[model samples]
Target: MAAADPPSPTGMGFFGMLSFRRSATAVASFDPAQEDELLALHALHAHVADRLEALSSHAQPQGPVLSLPFLSKLLDAVLSSSDAFRAVLALAPVAAAVSRPPADRLAADLLDRSIKMLDVLNAASLTLASLRGAHRAALTAASCLLAPALHRAHFARARRAIARIFPDDAKAGATAPSPSSRTMRALSVSVSKNWSAGRHMNAMAAHLAPPPQVPAAAAAGAGCGLGLALYTMSSVLVFAMWALVAAVPCQDRASAAISPPVAPPKQAQWAVPMSSLQDRIAEEWRRREKKGSSSGSAATAGLLAEMQAVERAARDLNSLLEEIAEEEEDEQAAVAIVSEERTREVTEQAEELAAACRALEDGLAPLERQVRAVFHRVVACRAEVVRCMEHVPRTASSNAAASASGVPPPQHHSF
Candidate 1:
């Protein structure tokens, strides 16, 4: 029975573990020097390009790029192979086009749809890149033509690939201060943190402070009144005249003597609450450790294990919270940009998107004129653009969907 064929790695089975590790291992098993997959992929691209050229020569609306349905597919196949090949052809015009949205609302919508189709192609490219593994220089080179600023994850992966060229930064004092040298550095950091907090508090106080115009006028009037009274009394030099003036009732204005209490800043309100929570948690942990230390070795071991678990949980919670904060900041930033970005810039971006979508849609125009409808949609998809922005928060979800569908996010302009 051949031991059931080792469970057939590529087959669909209930117990199949089709993970990145499995896929990577399978691809690594192949010898790139002997493999023809790279050659085949290139040929496929060449054939597609040839088809495109033929389509372009036609008097029909189809041009070199307007004809190849298999172009993206072939590019995917070539780039996916473990054998290294520079997919410069795929990187140039199509990637630029895929990133843009249409200018007009209707056109933007159409463009977005077309862009999405191309995203599937890119997704396939991502898979191929993943399988091939550690193509840093190639990917970095590709990213120049692809989404450069936005290719952080890719760049990071690329760095990891070429880490031998750039050794990991030193652990002790990489950024951390040496124990002996920590005094000045620690003081500086503490000072900076405290100053920031102080600045925030001061700003809040300023906002809460009452308008000074009223106080200024009141002080001036009071000074003038007192001066005049003193001058009059001095001129008279008569005790009887001063006594009569003092006995005379003046307009009651006691309220001016009292001051309104200033309101505390917004952050100030939450500072106590946050600090208290931290203090309580720290105290609980310290108490547990102390109790364990007082007990025998078994209790101490148990306490240490529990402490370790707690520490891990705390670390995980901190990580999760940090992620949440980052996501919130991203969302806020996107919102701020959407509202704050120049109308002209948005229009330009829309036009760029439209252009790219049109390019791809136009590519399909010859083989499938039916694709022209998609082109029209791409030209008109403003709502879709906004939706895409909203979906930024759900990147993992979108990425998962793209992977499941064997598609990738469209390689486009950073914005």
Candidate 2:
């Protein structure tokens, strides 16, 4: 029978299948393009890590109201950096599989670091959401207080003007409009509706027209007094018009009710010539009316233009706030999803690494046993050789001693 062939070295176990030696050779082969790709990946990882660290340091929440603009910018940066790092991480398993042990170790380390960074990003996104909610609450509270405060301020200014225009007795006796008065309601409504309408000077002129049926002396005295009051109340009229325009539901009806056409009294009946005083009053009224119709119209038009401009600005502000809020929400959702996915991916990678380790250990166990068996056989063979040599040793030395002592030598026996 043919001698039995020795076992064929058991295919070198898992080490042979993994071919780590081949990986080492591949690592030694430096294709510039591959080197460049690896370098790029490393650089990208460093950049992303730096950005994450910076964001983690800076994104601490601090106030009752967050600056939406700032938060929006921060979220954008975090998302971009996290996305870049995630892309790099996605290649980690492939790198680990194909590269040498050192590269595999680096890939595993990178995955761990990336997972930590993602956790940081998730925390920041949640903080931003909380801040947004707080900001919205603050805005709502301010909105609740705004209109009423403005109404109160407008009425207070109107009251002061009315006091300065009228006599102390009349002012003391006058009952000011209540906050809930229809006139105030009308004023607010009209301001909202007719603020852009063109000036109606005739209506204003009629409204300011003087009362009829006074004695010449009384008229003169009144004219002089009226002139003084008008001087004091010139500035008051501008604000008063705002109030009147707001208070009067209908301009035609208010004007008709306030001023009725009165025929001038017979000039002959007057003992004193009050023409100068009358002229002064009429001149003042005419000047004031003309100013209201002409220059005041221009001013009103400019004011309306300004108001419209402010409205546009407010609209833009509102839209920007809404955009920031929406972006925060979207970023938060993205962060949550990414974080969960990354966790699962990391778990899978860890399991794979563990499996690979277990496989390596299993493969190493049989190889260790084979090496021990070979070592034991070599030791036994050495012991047998030593025993045979001991039995045959000292023959030459013994023969030399016997010749010196005249002793007989042993003869060889033939089989």
Candidate 3:
């Protein structure tokens, strides 16, 4: 034996000690540029964490009511956090390139957390816009109350002007002239020299007319009989045509009456409960961290999975809102042309969209809660990591000093 080498500092075996030494050497040998980059990344993480905490504080409410002031503050916080988050995302690839495995995993987790926070912020923004729109609509409706009176005044003015143009006869005492009298008066005023000339020509022609070949009485009797026969034939034809029309069914009406009814669309369902998934992810992280495994990687994966689920729910909600918007546009365009029959259809569609919005909101509530809880947890974890990182260098320096002074290194708990 080569003078039984002094027991390794790690105390596991030669191999374990060698591994520890190698790791320490690698950390010590990190390029100055890489170290600077890592520090910058970590600082960015701290900034983002602070922003998140501020946002959460502003968003947190003890009661159901969300005041306008609170919402405004929350919006501001979210906007600031979003700006910091974007900066972090932009530097993520660079951070990944220079960071160790644990740090890399942490960066990824922070990215996921930031994305989820953004999703929550977006949903809140949409809700705020909707509330503002409804408020404006209520104000507009209130303003419309004055319209009817204005319209009445306008109509009265128009009626007065018309009465002046075509005044009613006071001497008539509400008894208007008959249609025959009016027509006769108009005809008398329209008569001219042409009418008198035509009447004189007709009298001259009748006086000089040739006599009929047959007796007048026989001719009259024959004419009457012919006219009676023609009348009877016309009456029979009219009755037959009416009966034919009544007996035949219309093809279009029959087809419409027998058309099949359309089936309603299926309602959407969420497969995973967001709250339960969040709990599972947090528990798994805790268990993995205790076991000394790569808990960061595991935790990041869980967060990603949860984030995807949340994104899906948010996407569905956005799609539903888009559909509602389209329906509203259609309703508005049709307002001028809408008939009594179509009004009911439009109303029914409005009700359906309202119901859909309510359902979407109900579904999003749980997801929002889950996101908030995860955000809080992630922020706490980040704080701990930052604290540990700050302590590590100080502890390492103290240990080196102790070793140089022939004193034992101070024992410390592993992170």
Top TM-score hit? 3
List, residue by residue over 226-310, the lDDT tens digit for candidate 3: 1211122122112211111111111111111111111111110111221222233334334433543443221111112222232
Which clashing pairs does model 3 show? none
Q: Per-prediction RMSD in angstroms?
A: 39.1, 47.0, 42.3
Put the candidates in TM-score order, highest first: 3, 2, 1
- Per-model TM values vs. the true structure: 0.13, 0.22, 0.25
**Which stretches in model 2 have alpha-carbon errors above 4 Å?**
1-33, 42-94, 97-100, 103-126, 148-415
Q: Could you give candidate 1's per-residue lDDT for residues 146-178 as a string of tens digits? A: 341322243233223223211232123223222
Which of the two, 1 or 3, has more TM-score? 3
lDDT of 2 at 75: 35
Error of 2 at 36 (Å): 3.7
**TM-score-best of 1 and 2:** 2
What value does the lDDT take at residue 155 in candidate 3? 23
